[model samples]
Target: MGTKWITFDLDETIMQNPFGKWVFPEIVNMLKKEADTEEDILDLIVSEHLQRMSEERFLEAYDWDDIITDVAEKLGAVSAIDIERMVIKHSEPPKIYLLEDNMLDYLEQIKEKGFHLAAATNGYSKYQLPVLQKLGLDKVFDEVITSDSAGFAKPNPAVLKKLSDEGEIAAHVGDRIDHDVLLANRLGILSVFVHRSLPAEVLSLPVDKRAEQPSCIRLCEEKWHKENRLREVPFMENECIPKVVVQSIGELAESIDFIIK
Candidate 1:
């Protein structure tokens, strides 16, 4: 039988959220609007804004409206609806790092080879799903698992367990060695490490496989650079690692074929 399942990691694997940039300001604005003083506003953002998305018990009761009301009410606000309106207005056309053109083609090729795919990444679905839709490859994957959805983020065995349960993932491809590769290995699932250059933190992990040519990643970096938009695209300068690193997603098919055989 074919391997059938391939789980992937988002953010630096499929997309990248530039540091110090996001929709935080809008949330902050809402806090400021409701609060009587700056101290009160900061307190609300600190108290309510910084919670783990996977806290299901908290999130189950805390929908978007609840989140707005909770934050606003913490600062002594009157209307949750107004805060939600501002939040949604600020959240309109959710910001996303777009995927490379080759991504769609590569995913199609992988599916043609009979592989089922899923995404296992950190962050809530609100932030993550938009990027998938922007990539236009949302329909390609059989499932998209998120840390928020799973109630745990990467490097956590629980996330991998949820990924495996989705179908039958034979392999997981990602950029972080500790969070992605090592986690996969812990569960006895094959791991493929992407990016030719890795951070010292990631390089410290024992990686099973590596790849450098991440087209989707490259495109996102290029767009950010071209747009002069927000944060700088982090690029690795060294090429000294001693592992086989391919330049494109299509190359993964060949590498996996050899490994599976």
Candidate 2:
């Protein structure tokens, strides 16, 4: 029998940076002087990064230097010294927190079921590897595939195809619909959406009620568009839909059994 593989996205799936990704106050103050508004700083940073990413064909994993350089050039006011400071601050390693308290135990259970596991993430290996080591996840995953290592990011089937070559992929679990679900669906693997941070109740609420909540608005505007860069891409029903949805990693083992059966 072929090896049965279960692939997972690292960030916000099994683990996450508890502090979350945020612009430093000092950097914000520096950019504010050149930016039209406080929001413009963030807007320009994202736009410039995406523009550069398109130029590179999204194959290479960009670092802080690349983003800071592009943003600084676009602003046309920030000094190289200030830009260097921003890069230094942003380049610092994040403190990782495993979402599930018994995450490793659950993973071991899954492994005992004869399923080989993999972490297929968009993060660069330099960043992702350390997090895995800190969380002791380095010992659990059979394969750790990162954008830098794989030469492609999520939503691109090539990233997952590398693992598919080694075994029959039973399922791919992740927190993002656009990236994780889309990629798995494209490759005909069962997509499992794990809502680690957001619960189903928030999602089930009426659109109007959901709009009243800050989390829902952030999810809709920031996560859906800003982080994933899905604004330009045309939405397809099959691409964003997952075969199975679970609220936590604790629920994943049962879902995996149902999928393979």
Candidate 3:
């Protein structure tokens, strides 16, 4: 495949965050130590922080460390040390479900074929980077782009603009239609959506191509003698809808190989 570049998503695409179970519990425990009323603390501090972010709001808000401090102060008795410890504990990662069957092997295959690769996610860069390293896949990416750094999240054309600015990217693969497929489609990059969590019937709407998983995409090469039904699905949305849907990153490679050829 003569494809120049490929981009990917992080959470649910590469890994899973057990934060709902582990991280939340840790936060609750720390809150217990504070001398303030839990009611007021949860409402004022936590709620305000969770509100939607605008450029102005983001600039006005506390940085990551300061956010921790605000939460601790709300408890009236929590310590910075405790907050730090909790963060460190929860940070133990890869947080991804590294499915056993030679996952990295497929990525290496694409790399060997000379395609540039990147990751564009809505997550924060500071936290997302550590998870990639834990999976030992950090070195695979030529670039790691995140919403925090990009100043805009997915479905935003500006983020796609960043991808184009870096180089000529051929495809963008991700799990969500709204953020990944739609946005990629709008940006003129071939969009490939992996239906790992969603069923095929549910996505029966027109897509350039479809597959069960990343590995299965190899069928494009495996059955070279057979006519490949590959589709050059373009981005789509207000003109941004993704044209292709696959099951895994491996399949994304296969589709790309077929498209580029």
In TM-score terms, which candidate is top?
2
- Report the C-alpha lDDT of model 1 over 29-89, residue by residue, as the tens digit: 6567667865744445444433422232333322444555666776687744543334333
Provide the overall lDDT of each model, using Cα atoms, as 2-decimal numbers. Answer: 0.55, 0.68, 0.59
Model 1: per-residue Cα lDDT at residue 155: 56
TM-score of 2: 0.72
lDDT over C-alpha atoms for residue 57 of model 3: 42
Q: List the residue pairs that clash in candidate 1.
A: 213-247
* Candidate 3 off by > 4 Å: 1-3, 35-50, 53-78, 81-88, 91-96, 99-101, 160-162, 198-240
lDDT of 1: 0.55
| Per-residue C-alpha lDDT of model 2 across residues 1-261, encoded as one tens digit per residue | 888988999888898732135333455456667656435665665566567555544544345446656666666655553433343344434545688889998898888889999999887666566568767899999999988788788878988777678779988888887678778889898877776456466656532243345554444344445545633654455566566666677777744565566
Candidates by TM-score, descending order = 2, 3, 1
- Candidate 1 residue spans exceeding 4 A from truth: 1-3, 16-22, 36-94, 160-167, 196-254
- Where does candidate 3 have its weakest 10-residue lDDT segment? 220-229
Using lDDT as the yardstick, the better of models 2 and 3 is: 2
lDDT of 3 by residue, 29-123 (tens): 66666664636544444444444232224322323445556666756754554433443456564434454356577777777777877888877
Ranking by lDDT: 2, 3, 1
